[model samples]
Target: MPGCFINYRTGDGEHVATLIDRELKQRFGSGEVFRASRSIDAGQDYVRALDAAVRRCEVLVAIIGPAWLDSPHRSGGDGRALDDPDDWTRREIATALSLGTPVIPILFDGAARLRPADLPEDMRGLARCQNRRLHHRSAESDLADIIEAVEVAAPRLGDMGEDESSEGDSGQSSGGGVANTMRDVSGGTVAQSREFHGVNGISGRTGDMVFGNSGPVNTGTGPQYNGSTVHNGTGDQIGVQRVHGSRNGGESR
Candidate 1:
């Protein structure tokens, strides 16, 4: 399996990091993932270690939260408390874009809520990639989605040889297959969530289905449903807003 570089907000960074690490360990015997918490050494070397980890990875999964934008690194304010471009998560996003790596923008909080000016220009370039949503308080389902995305983005040789459940040697299974352990702030888990496969272009949960592809295939079919698929109190589609992932429970989409 290829190493993964996770780009997420500090606030929710630990939660997302934990989920990714668990899945990686399950699949590759705990040696594959370069998680910041466990991989980083003490002192000044830690910063360099993180940068090295980012460079070594093939796929960059950015766990986007509402605070993604307005980063201090981009603003040049706060008396330059953090180093230039250091605090800027956008810089990492830009690096991924520049490297032409497969960038998966996992929508935690709604990305649509951001105005164009509020976001890093590179993130706005996401006008075309596949965007996934992890509903409020739904960590387990989100964890499953993360594993699925990893399978799509970074699969190892052993993974090809065995079944999906075998992908996780951790003894955790998603029913008959591998399982993802996720819990919200309240520690409650969510059932299966909807996900799109092989489709290019944008697929977000903001308001209505907003997507378009310039390629031969048109994946602009609109929102996909899983469960009840009923309208909310206002009679609007229920799964519109982009709820973020957290140790605390997420909103039911």
Candidate 2:
């Protein structure tokens, strides 16, 4: 069963919905999130599939973009899409509300807070529920907040998410702590800390350094030097030299 259902308008909030689905699937498991585009199979009765998914989901996220409230109706009517009784976005939200599922309103891309007057009668209650904001500049933090909220609302899903996370972390060495493997180090050092728990390994190249580690591993990169001399801690001398074409160079003391 899906732990969360994403309700979003096709042309208005679809992108945001996809983002939410991807993030949630990463945090929770793939089976825990239900998005119409991915969850519904070809030749399946879409209506029935949507209804079943909505009913079974523990939480419903209503992705409201700037144009969501006033988008054109599917039937080419002049009124807003939400005003139409047949609008899938409207129906999905209504069904989730009727089922007493926790409906979370996610304001996206500078969308304003929902007002009761702007919603159809059935969806007016959505305005009363607390909302979370997702902006491009603050997406990471916002996503974290959404995940935390979901964890609190559905503890079972939370447990499963944690398990999956731990499994990815376990691929790193035992002594490695959680850290950001990807960072900008153009001018100075960037320190990152991350907690790992799962079987996923870190493998990537940033600048001149290449990292491929399985098991808990902490790595860092700093300024490279060519034929530089340095004093050892015990008053000894050491020389550092970089081979022109090689990633690793020999050091002599």
TM-score for each of the candidates:
0.52, 0.66
Model 1 residue 85 CA deviation in Å: 3.3
Give the 10-residue window scoring lowest on summed lDDT in candidate 2: 244-253
Over the stretch 1-253, how does candidate 2's per-residue lDDT look in tens digits? 7889989888888888889899998777689999999999899999999989998899999999888888997778798888888889999998888878888999988898989999999998899888899999999999999888787777888887677667557533333433334433343343333322221222222222322322221233344333356555699877754312221111111
Candidate 2 segments exceeding 4 Å error: 165-253
Candidate 1 weakest ten by summed lDDT: 243-252
Model 2 TM-score is 0.66
- What number of backbone clashes does candidate 1 have, counting pairs of residues 3 or more apart or in separate chains? 15
Model 1, 1-253: lDDT tens digits are 2367767766544575666677656654454666666766567586667666676667677776555554344345663312345564566666767777677777765654444454446556544557667665886787677767766776552364256456446434343332333222122223322343233332333212222322121122433332334465697866433322221111112
lDDT (0 to 1) per candidate = 0.53, 0.73
